[model samples]
Target: MTDQQSKLLKGKQILVTGGAGFIGSNLCEVLLNQHVKVVCLDNFSTGKRINIEPFLQNQNFKLVEGDIRHLEDCKKACLNIDYVLHEAALGSVPRSINDPITTNDVNVSGFLNMLVAARDAGVKRFVYAASSSTYGDHEALPKVEDTIGKPLSPYAITKYVNELYADIFHTTYNFDTIGLRYFNVFGKRQDPNGAYAAVIPKFVQQFIDHESPIINGDGSYSRDFTYIANVVQMNINALTTENKDALNTVYNVAYGDRTTLLELATLLKTYLSEFDASIKTIEIKHRENRVGDIPHSLASIEKAKRLLDYNPQYNISAGLKEAVVWYWEHLK
Candidate 1:
C-alpha cells in the first residue's frame, strides 16, 4: 500500500462488493493489510470463493454473501460502511451480446441499487469499476475519459450507463462517487477457467497445458493491459483523495502503455517457459475478431496522476513476469 493510502484507509470501515471476485478480492486484501475493517459482499455468480478463502480468518474481514442486484442486499452491505468500492457487475462484451438483459440488470440496475444504498447510508465515497469498453467505436489511439463515442455492445451500454447514473447521483443527491475506467486488467487470483475469462489468464492456462492459444484477430489488436496492483492502487486513491476536482468524475486506470496481442502471447510464452520448457513450443493461433471487438485500445492516465496522485508501479513486462510466476506456483 502507498503512504497516502495507509493514512486515509487505516481503521476505516469499507464495503467491497464482488469481494470474492478477482479485483474485489485484491482490494479486500490490501485494505485488510492496512488494518481497515472490510465487509465483503459477493453473489458468487462469476466470483470464486477460493479467491477470498484466505481472508475468511482475518478478524477485520467480514463476508456477506448477497447479490448487488437486490436493493436489500445492497443496503445491508452498506450498513456502517465508511466507503464503498463497487465492483459487482457482469463483464465481457461477448457475454453481453449473448444475454443483454441479464447484463443490463446486473450492471445498470445493480449499480443503481448500490449508489442509492450508499447515498442513504451516508458513505463517504463510492468508487466503481468502469471499463475501457465504454470507448466503443471511437477510433482514438489513447482514450481520454471525457471524449467517449457511442457504445457498440450491450456490455458497453451498461457500463456507460453506470457513469451516467453516478453523475446524476452526485448532481441530484450530492452523493460522492468516482469511476475508474479500467483497461485489460490481469494478475494474481484472476480466474483462468471461465468462458469469459480475460486473455492473459486464459492464455497462461493454455500454455501451461501445452495447448495452442487463439488470438481473436491477426494479433495486431492492442490493449493497455493493466496490472491488478495498479488497479488496487487506483481504487484506494479514488477512495482516499481529498481533491474536490477528482470527485464525481471518471479517470482511466491503466499502465499508460499498450501491447499488441502477438507481443502479449510471445511474452506469456517466454515467461511460462521458465517454469516448463515445453511451453516454448506451444503454438499461438489466430481467429477472426469477434463482434464488437475494438481493433485497438489505450488510455491517457494523466487525469489520475494529476488529481489522485496515481503512480502505476508495473508495466506489462514487470506485471506479466509476476503474474506468470504466481500462475506457475498456484495453478501448475
Candidate 2:
C-alpha cells in the first residue's frame, strides 16, 4: 500500500457523492489512504453508514447526510471541494424497469444538480461514474467509446445522458471533466442484501450460506467484470492528468477480458466454498432472461491505456479471489 501511495492525491479535497455504496465506499477508503481530504455525501438510499464507519475518526474524512436530488444538499456538499467523483445513481436495470421515474429523478436530475453545484464550487475537475450499459443493444463484442446503441433501459439512458451532459459542461461552461465508463464492477463492500444486488456479491453470499445460487438465462451471459482497485487507479489518473487530450474525454475502465455467467458462478462457488466443503456441492436454479438485460458486454480499454495510462492490476480470477475472501470473512 505504501509503494502505491507515491501518487498520493496529497493536497486535493475530493467530494464523493454516494460514498457509502460498494464502489463509493471502496473509493473513499482508497482516497483516504492516499492522504486526500474526502467529503462523502450520502442520503443512505442504497448506501450504508457502516461502510464509512471506520473513517469517522480520521480528520481527513467528513460525512454529510444529504440527497443529490436536492440542490441545497448538493451545494452544501461541494463547498470547498477541489474535485468531484460523482458515483450517486440507482444502478440496477431491472429496478429501473420497475420504477423508471425514480431512476430518472435520482440519476438524471440528481446528477445535473451535482454538476451545477460542482461548477458553482469552482472545482478543478469533475470525474464521474459512467456505465458500460450505455452500449445497450449494440451487439458488439467489445464496446468502443464512439459507438453506442439506443438505451435498452431507463438506467442505461440515465448513464448515457451523464456522458452527454459532461461533454456539454466541458464545451459550454468550460468545466474540465472526465468520465470513466465502468464495465461490470464487483468487489468488496458490494451489498448482498438487496433485490438489486450485483451478481458477484449475491452469488458469493449465497454460496457461503449454502443456498443455491440462481443463474439467469442458462448462465450463458458474459461480462467484462472489473475490480474496484483498477477503477480507483483510473479515477486517480483522471483527477491528476493535465494532458490536453485526456480532459473532457470518456475512457473505458475495465479489465479488457470477459467471462460467462456459468464460468463466474463456478469460480465464486469454488473460491468461497473452500472455507466449508458443504458449500461446494450447491446447485444452481435457472431463471427466465431478465428484461432490458444484454446477453454480453465487453469494453475496448485501449483508449484508457493510451490516454489515462491505466494499467489494471487484477484480472477476473485475481479479483474474484480477493472478493470471495472478503465476503467470506465479513459477510459471514
Candidate 3:
C-alpha cells in the first residue's frame, strides 16, 4: 500500500460488496493488510467462495453472504460502514445480452439499493466498479471521461445508468460518490472457468492446458488491459482523495496503454512457456467477433492523475509477468 492510502484508510471500516469476487477480494485483502476493518458482502452467483476463504479467519475481515439485488441485503451490509466499495454487478456483454432482465436486476436495481442504503447510513464515500463499456460506439483513440457515445449492449446501458444515478445521488441527496471506469482488468483470483470470463485468464488457462485459445476477431481488437493492482490503487485513491475537485465525479482506472489480442496471446504464450516449454507450441485460433464487440479501447487517465493524484504502477508487460506466475502456481 502507498503511504497516502495507509494514512487515509488505516482505521476506517469498509464495506466491499462482491468481496468474494476478483477485484473485490483483492480489495478486501489489501484493506485487511492495512489494519482496516472490512465487511464483505457476496451472493456467490459468479463469485467463488474460495477466492475469499483465506480471509474468513482474519479478525479484521468479516464476510456477509447475501445478494445485492435485495434492499435488505444492501442495508445489512451498509450498517456502521465508513465507506462502500460497490463492485457487485453482472458483467460481460454476452451475458447481459442473453439475460438482460437479470443483468438489470443486479446491476441497476442492486446499485440503486446500495446508493439508498449508503445514503441512509451516511457513509463518507461510495466508490463503484464502472466500466469502459460505457464508451460504447465512440470511435476515439483514447477515451476521456465526459465524452461517450450511445451504449451498444444491455450491459453498457446498465453501467451508464449507474453513472447517471450516482450523479443524481450527489445532487439530490448530497451523497459523496466516485465512479472508476475500468478497462479490461485482469490478475490473480480472476475466474477463468466461465463462458463470460475475460480474455487474459481464459487464454492463460487454455495455454497452460496446451489447448488452442480462440480469439474473437482477427486478433486486431485491442484494449487497455489494466492490471488488478492498478485497479486496487485507483479504488483506494478514489476512497481517500481529499481534493474537493475529485469528489462526485468519475475517473478512468487503467494503465493508460492498449494491447492487441494477437499481441496479448503471444505474450501469454511466451510467459507460460517458461513454466512448460510445450505451451510454446499451443496454437491460437481466430473466429468472428462476437456481437456488440468494440474494435479498440484506450483510456486517457489524465483526469485520475489530475484529480486523485493517481499513478499506475504496472503496464501490460509487467502486470502480465506477475499474473502469469500466479496462474501457473495456482491453476497449474
* Collision count for each candidate, in order: 0, 0, 0
How high a TM-score does candidate 2 get? 0.97
| Alpha carbon lDDT at 182, candidate 2 | 91
Per-residue lDDT value at 192 in model 2: 90
TM-score of each: 0.99, 0.97, 0.99
> Per-model C-alpha lDDT, please?
0.93, 0.90, 0.94
Higher-ranked by TM-score: 2 or 3: 3
Least well predicted 10-residue stretch by lDDT in candidate 3: 1-10
- Tens-place lDDT per residue, model 1, 49-118, is 9999999999999999999889999999999999999999999999999999999999999999999999
Tens digits of lDDT, candidate 2, 151-242 = 99999999999999999998999998998899989888889988898998888888878899899989989999998888888888888776
Give RMSD to native, each candidate.
0.8, 1.5, 0.8
Winner on lDDT (1 vs 3): 3
Model 1, runs deviating above 4 Å: none
Residue 31's C-alpha lDDT in candidate 1? 89
Per-residue lDDT tens digits for candidate 3, residues 145-228, read 999999999999999999999999999999999999999999999988888998999999899888999999899999999999
